[model samples]
Target chain A: MNQDKMGKGEQSRARLLQAAAVQFAAVGYHRTRVSDIVRQAGLTQAAFYLYFPSKESLYQELMDGFFQKLWELSDAGGKVTPLARHEVRDRMKENLLELFRFFARMPEQTRIVLTGAEEREELHRKLTSIVSANLRKNQEAGHVRPELSVEVAAESMLAVVQRLTVRFLLSGERTAEQLAEDAAALLAKGILQADRTKEE
Target chain B: MNQDKMGKGEQSRARLLQAAAVQFAAVGYHRTRVSDIVRQAGLTQAAFYLYFPSKESLYQELMDGFFQKLWELSDAGGKVTPLARHEVRDRMKENLLELFRFFARMPEQTRIVLTGAEEREELHRKLTSIVSANLRKNQEAGHVRPELSVEVAAESMLAVVQRLTVRFLLSGERTAEQLAEDAAALLAKGILQADRTKEE
Candidate 1:
């Protein structure tokens, strides 16, 4: 109950979480055991239980934390439309850069998030719906293309972001800013030549 | 073996495969046991073993079959560059339609393919590299935009196709042809308005 004890408890919990993340990333969620986490953290089973009741709870906490951070980052960007096309693209690139940087800083967390765990489906659905809603708003405001299916476009865009994060950012092959810029370009103009389309 | 016995063996193997696919789809690959598959097929363990050495082998066979079918469908369309832009779009749409139809007919197989299993990483890598190589060739031929990173474009395109298939085609919300056309349009022109970009 004292301040020092509470601080120690918080430290212990953080250690356990870090250990769990490492183990989960190395051996995967299904194979990772609570014992391994405790051992890696240099804590006893009692200490782990005091913090997380089970390995599943620990994993859930990790996922929840990541999703929370992601939502906050995206929400901080506010509405995406009502700006010029280039301005909107710049905002998208900035938001994605922040997101990729967050993921890149924690490759273990990135792996777990991208692993398609059953628990992640709910979060994925929520994120997709949020994006769909945003796109719908933008379409109504005449910012996005009118012909595009909001739902399909949201899902596809999220998929592209996730895949790029895993392939490039996680591997440290490219910086978050560079990947974000490329992704924004692709999402904005696609892979087709601009002049060629006009000529056609 | 005699022709009659071989024919029966083939029939039994096909039955087991169907049953395994059903069970795996219902309960997922990790939870579905060899016993459950055999029971569903109304066959013996000996028979299942006579065809697939293990459950992993059966799952691998299923994946291989899907990949083979997909490759054949794409290859049948031939090279994409020789055709005009419209023709290329049609070819891409038609190929995607066939692929979507394949997934629609067997949603269970689609679930397995999209589940991101460890065994699937190799197949995914192979598919991405093939797409990247094709994109590189197109860029060289001045068909694709030279500014785009072939690797990133390939991965993003594949991700979009997969997400669309799972969300639309697999769910039966849209016909394969409709989804393919919309997907092709998005892939070709992207999600942005044409004149808006020029104006900006």
Candidate 2:
């Protein structure tokens, strides 16, 4: 595609994703129609198809962006000085803190990712991959337990983070700061991998 | 209600619940209509209202059954002995293993509980109460750390369990026995508790 067309495509797609996130989160995926998203984006209804072929695609894009940002946090930690294996968890904790802080501000994606859309096999599969990769990376760095399976560890830990974030959004009880702090503790202690016990 | 009528009512309700679970798991809460449930249950559609005012009520009843069984497990453990804290967890593990094994065999409620319905406000509230009560019981028994806020501990721990269970359901990778054992270790090690350095 030409650069101009590519740029336009990206812009419209971004607007649709942003609009979808709001509508889907507020009214839910089943309730949010193409017309609603177009109206929210202030774009033509047919134009949404120009960006996303369907609602599920739009949801995938939204999740793609959300996870891309989360993955970036882990990558950003690479710039920090390397600590010993145990000490490296502090860096991971910082990454978790940043991720939780970012999530608190965007409960729309947070809700869907944690609970709503995870029911969809496609979305759940994509999320599983994202989690598995991150866990492997942390394991490779020696910051996480090698004895534990990264795939299970990743899914397990993501479940904890996702659940806590959803509750934060739902109950309106926890502040972003509090969530970040709690997430830090969850990571530092390896809440999912504690005891390095047998996989269950 | 008369005994005969009550017995019939209970039988009808059980069948209704079974039909609802299958439909809800298959099509999801929003998509699964009450007509579909009654049809699946081989009953008149209007009769559903007699048992459940709404489809949501059926779901509520299902959840109530789940919570009641969990408490029963705790009660059984209480009858045995209190001196062996680890035994409580062991029996708890056995209870959960049976529960989750049944869960695995049953169609799919992991998603229904987390993401099936739109908003799931009432469901979350029920879950929160069940979790809160369980945490309080453990604290009173001195099995859980009294210093930690019951609300936070309960919700967080529930989140952890729910997340892992969903992952297990979606991935179909982890064995139930392994999950129960790992959870036992995690609980024993105080991973879900407030602090690691200090005694509970």
Candidate 3:
């Protein structure tokens, strides 16, 4: 049936995207070819164009999907319960750790998304939307300091996590889980040492 | 006459490296070519190979120089004058801003060094050396906590600034100075609402 054919096409498209993500991230965008991506996906070269208009457009989609997923995950079941500060911190930590675990689990995908850049303003704007929207939500919840611009706070936090993960993955010095937990603790603890037993 | 020839060669080599850094960072490592680098430096392709064996090796040198400069500049001079806790935070802020500004001034060089892979393990060892050495200096003067592992702290700080710089540059949003200043404040304050004023 026509409907059955459409379903098969969608499945093929998804598989192609998955394969492309790995190849692009591992070797980079410029180095990868349409034939190579289709070969990895066990599909013909024609299958690629059936899904993506061009390599550039596919890259744009990959990046768009990446940040969109992150935003969804972060925003899902979100906002700390107005519990004790430590409790809120624990919840925040758990959410962040989940994100890192996702990265560690699918590092190839993470690399692809983070390093992937296309010469398109529209895609960058989408990425910015994902980041800025999360910032606004956090601001509304009063989870972050109101004094700081939501944009700065959100972007800065993202920058920290991105670099930290890159170091952990590339350097192989620390476990991803440990880095995520420690980062949360530090960010929650503030800069100056407190009377709390935990050393600042 | 031999000495004059050597001096000219050294100057030619310097020019090539500088040109390569600009092109590599802007166009990325893969996109840059030996021909373009030579042309940019107003020299001959033969002259480029005379100093560097290949583009990759030239990139390696550029990376090495970057790490070496970071080491030389990581010095804190002295601890914050225990007047106000905010003063300590402010001083820390200033240091990060200065460092980020230093990197931003040479964005091309920054990109080449930052956008490399795990094959460069020797470079990691070198960079970590700079970090640990600086921390040890801070510890010796009673500025850094002896209990804290200098390696993690150093890497953590580096990650924050580097990641933030990437976002700042790639997004074309924040001015380099604004990003540097804001990122410094964020790093110094860590990300908590806790009263750092008590440290004063």
Best by lDDT: 1
DockQ of 2: 0.33
In the range A31-141, model 3's lDDT, one tens digit per residue, is: 999998999999987878888999889877776766666666556324553433335566667777887877776676677666555422344345456656755655465
Can you write out model 1's per-residue Cα lDDT over B79-183, one digit (the tens) per residue?
875655445556667777887788787777877766547436876787787777777766675556667787888888889888888777877888887788767
- Which candidate, 1 or 2, would have the higher DockQ against the true structure? 1
Segments in model 3 whose C-alpha atoms lie over 4 Å from true places: A1-69, A76-87, A105-108, A114-128, A169-177, A189-200, B1-19, B28-31, B41-67, B75-90, B116-125, B132-152, B169-177, B191-200
Q: Highest DockQ, which number? A: 1
lDDT of 2 by residue, B16-86 (tens): 88888888777787798988988888888778988888888888877666656544543343432343454
- Local distance difference test, per candidate? 0.75, 0.64, 0.65
Cα-based lDDT at residue A34, candidate 3 = 93
Compared with the true structure, what per-residue lDDT tens digits does model 2 show for residues A114-161? 556534466556666766676666667655556666565555555666
DockQ (C-alpha based) per candidate is 0.47, 0.33, 0.28
**How good is the docking of model 3, as DockQ?**
0.28
How well does candidate 3 match the true structure in TM-score terms? Answer: 0.62
